[model samples]
Target: MEETYLLNVEGVKKKILHGGQGELPKLQDGSKFTFHFQTLKDDFERTVIDDSREAGMPMEIIVGKMFKLEIWETLLSSMRIGEVAEFWCDAIHTGMYALVSRGMRRIAEGRDPLEGQKHRCGMGNMFDYHSTGYEDLDELQRTPQPLIFIMELFRVEDPSAYKRDTWAMSKEEKLAAVPVLHSEGNRLVLRREFAQAAAKYQEAVICLRNLQAKEKPWEDGWLKLESLVTPLVLNYCQCQLELGEYYEVLEHTTELLQKHNDNAKAYFKRAKAHAAVWNEREAREDFQRVAHLDPSMAAAVKKELKQLGERMRKKHVEDRKRYQGLFQSSQG
Candidate 1:
């Protein structure tokens, strides 16, 4: 007679093996397998994926049962008596198996199966497969596996190396000095060092812009670093604004706003810069966008907007009166 047993992957204790009759399976070095399993419960009613198939075997009968477990049948079948298998499953499923193997780790653990499971299957939920066993219900309650897949796939890289490399440079070391100089420039600005800050911010912007321009579009890190430019440019514009360089503010802020129109603070600041230069029309437009992008700031920006309107009306009337006087003088 053929015998069967279950094998649980390491760090995935909630799952247990049910098919090894004699010896456990051996895992190859650095090899891993990914598979799905079914759990069985008292009210387990198998949903026949195929209606014509008869279900009498434990594997078939328990296939649709509700329970939480991860089993490695292939590893079990391949075992040569002294092999170890290891893999990871998340906490919820792992917890379920832990409860089963450890005999209900908590007495207060809910009997509903879905109570503690963070992942679940339903029409709207992730991993919403139809239930087969009580354990499966627990699996359903847990978050979907696909979401985990995506999270792992798009994991962010650590920036520690970049920070370290940028910080360890002498003034004369052009290769490593730029970021440090930029940092010093920022520090000077914080100390009310407008001139020093502008110099530093300019150096950093030039360095980054040069690097971006030299980078081949298809290079791996090029695109990633290119995304840094917009923020740096915005910072440059802010430095200019702080130094009361309205013309420079106009130049950099215009570019920054063009690239990042969604930033309400940028629009508000640009409005101020325009007003400083007596560019009433442009300032009015920027203030309008600031209010539109952030309704809560509408009240504050409304006053400036009203003032701009009054100024425009007064200018219009003065121009009309000046033209009328010029015509009268010419006729006289």
Candidate 2:
């Protein structure tokens, strides 16, 4: 197919590798488009940078959501479903590619995509952080250039087709939803519905995190949001503990303690998780830390330590019996 310039979209040229069915669908606000994309350098080598296919999931972007790579929405809107096309976007349109790629990579790794982001624009962040944590993206950030995008439009869904995720909500909407979610979570907890309660707490935490990501990290705004996140996280950890997800409890509590080492509740929760996981030494250490941090928790810590000791003793006896039985059986 001959290369074509998108109408009124300067600095971008498109060529359809494979024609798609029907005309371009209505790309309305809140419409979701799912597509697999490969980002390549414009050089002869066409060095690959990012591939949603390699990430094992197609990318989904909502229309008119102020996505980082606005050019992508423009490129996708020009195509039909099942279309495979390549677009060469000029440096201006591709400037935010590195930032978008970093978030995509983090998502592929099962991490918080907004974990390291700050209240800065794409270019501002590129200059501030000096790296996307990926070598290729860093080079692109260092020297801006045009890029080639090979995209396959797989599916399109209207806004009403699915529930909106926290990321899809407006800032005001997200902020409004958090307290409602928190209350529902509390209600669920009262009903002993731990798993459902955990989901609510997690959703609220995600909403807060989404808000916090828009603020400079460790600043007053971010710290204030983080303070709100703490209680929700602790509540989530409590549910996980009740659900016997000891490892998850350990992970959450450890992360919490890393930021606030003096949080007695975190240390206590972590101590309980450690005890459940049979890490006697670690459990004892955390329990001691809890006692030191909050004198009021001393009695509770002592009780936990005694229970831990009893459980350990019981486990030892069980192990001894099993080993003795094995030895006897082998001799026989």
Candidate 3:
């Protein structure tokens, strides 16, 4: 066995495996460190839970961002580039490891790491009572066990060394960026980039929702925030319609209509989804309502109703022929 020496970096223990070549450099806050990490369960070094290397990428964090395990910052702070070490992190440090690993995994897969859970208030909330809803993550939340991290120090740079995107921004920064995001989303929608457009609108919705959560519902402040979100939410629903997420369109538009009965766009969008799914009666009613609310849409509704009538007629004829064929087969 290689000589094992125990060193405490902010109460976390590290057993140096191989100290890489070159002299260590000075590290400070906002210093960027990129490295690949492998996490193992408990003292069982063979049972790997997560590995950045296997995921085909390394993780990077600005020293002060607290992006990953805080102990990671401390441990990485001590190593030079190309160094390899195994750090035994306590529950306090590894408690949020599961969530961080989830994000890292998502990034490696080219998906948004913050997908579906962007409404979380802070990193603390990631470990809060809210289960990641992922079974493995829930287990980690249930048991804050110690973990072993095998890491290779890659490179360290200053914060100014790389461009910062919206993901790296704080809450206030994100909220401030909402207008830019909304414009970008609108641009994407115009370009027919439905998926990316949906993402941008959804991110804006998340920001607005987080802001609204802080204020009482229906209050001036809350309504003001909601007003800002209405167009974005509708835009998101519009993209969902194009993406064939009909049930989602129905769900959100229904909720939207319940709150604002005169929302012609909501009625129109919902009616389109209803028509797509062959909901004739509901679609007719919604279209009628939209025509009543916004007379400008009446011509469009007329054209849609004409096409729907033809489609329904053809469908009924096809159904009758199929039934007749089945009846003859059974009789014979």
lDDT of each: 0.50, 0.91, 0.81
Candidate 1, residue 169: Cα displacement in angstroms equals 9.7
144-194 in candidate 2: lDDT tens per residue?
799999999999999889777888988888888889999999999999999
**Candidate 3 accuracy as TM-score:** 0.71
Which portions of model 3 miss their true places by more than 4 Å? 1-9, 20-33, 40-50, 54-68, 90-147, 155-167, 193-196, 210-221, 243-245, 258-261, 329-332
Which pairs of residues collide in candidate 2?
A: none
Cα misplacement distance, residue 9 of candidate 2 (Å) = 1.6
The lDDT-based order of candidates, best leading, equals 2, 3, 1
Q: Which candidate achieves the best lDDT against the true structure?
A: 2
RMSD in order of candidates: 19.7, 4.7, 5.0
Scored by lDDT, model 3 comes in at 0.81
Q: After superposition, how far is residue 111 of candidate 1 from its true place, in Å?
A: 80
Of 2 and 3, the candidate ahead on lDDT is 2
Off by over 4 Å in 2: 44-49, 109-119, 129-139, 183-196, 213-230, 247-271, 274-332
Considering TM-score, which of the candidate structures 2 and 3 is the better prediction for this target? 2
For model 2 the local lDDT of residue 195 reads 100
In model 1, the Cα lDDT at residue 77 comes to 38
